[model samples]
Target: MLYLCIVNQTASQNAEEFGFHAGDIVQQWLWDDDVDDSICTKIEDLTGEDLVDEDYGTAVDGVVIWWRDGDDEDTLADTIVDATTMLEDNGPVWVLAPKPGRPGAASSSTVQSAAKTAGMNAATPLTVSKDWNGIRLRAFGKGR
Candidate 1:
């Protein structure tokens, strides 16, 4: 016997494009930062998951860390550590930063290095929103 599964093309496309999965428990680590509601709504619409805004409160399937250039490295590192602890096994963490040439934009290298320090591996870059780009990284001790 053979079986076929049908999926929504548009949802699948959005998932692939945004690096989000349906039912994922996404924690938006804002660090007291403000993000446009439209961006948050778009993510929810695409992934069918509710965004959680908390400080390392619960285990999550995915995490979106909002960062800015000129932010303190030590503070960022501490947040990364906390995020790693709260992430579910094999969960991905995306570091969202301002796009290059934008005010308070962090370089790609900086994000990559931070991921490395957190014992995560950078997988791919994603354009998450109009004002922010993301670097997707996998948590340590899990195989993709």
Candidate 2:
């Protein structure tokens, strides 16, 4: 498992890094144009299910929030909370943001602070793409 966590890994090689499972119904929060497309495709491929963003008519297995610096405002907590409406019990909320030194990157402290405010615990982060890093936020007592 540790060997699979290296940076610059292919989409499939990094699937476990995001904890995706087969048939998972992952809800997409906000998709900025700058978001990495390969990661999304890999998720769909690995799960054999398309990511759902509209209607949210069913309980979702997990959520992916494409975040940026501006998204870390007071609403960050609100957004995180809102994203949890239909989440599975102990479901994860992945906050993907630009890496440090990149435009619109949210600081690690800021991301963790918002997660705390939203009543979630930010877990070990993963490299989502060359320019993006992701933090897996879990409800207390919910994740590894």
- Highest TM-score model number: 2
RMSD versus native structure for model 2 = 3.1
Candidate 1 lDDT, tens digit per residue, 53-86? Answer: 7654777877778888998766666777787687
> What's the number of clashes in each of the models?
0, 0
> Global lDDT of each model?
0.71, 0.82
Off by over 4 Å in 2: 1-14
Model 2, residue pairs in steric clash: none
Please report the candidate that would top lDDT against the real structure. 2
The C-alpha TM-scores of every prediction are: 0.76, 0.86
Q: Tell me which residue pairs clash in candidate 1.
A: none
Per-residue lDDT tens digits of candidate 2, residues 24-143?
899988786898888888888888999998368899988898889876456778888888988886666899989989999888788889889998888766777789999999887774
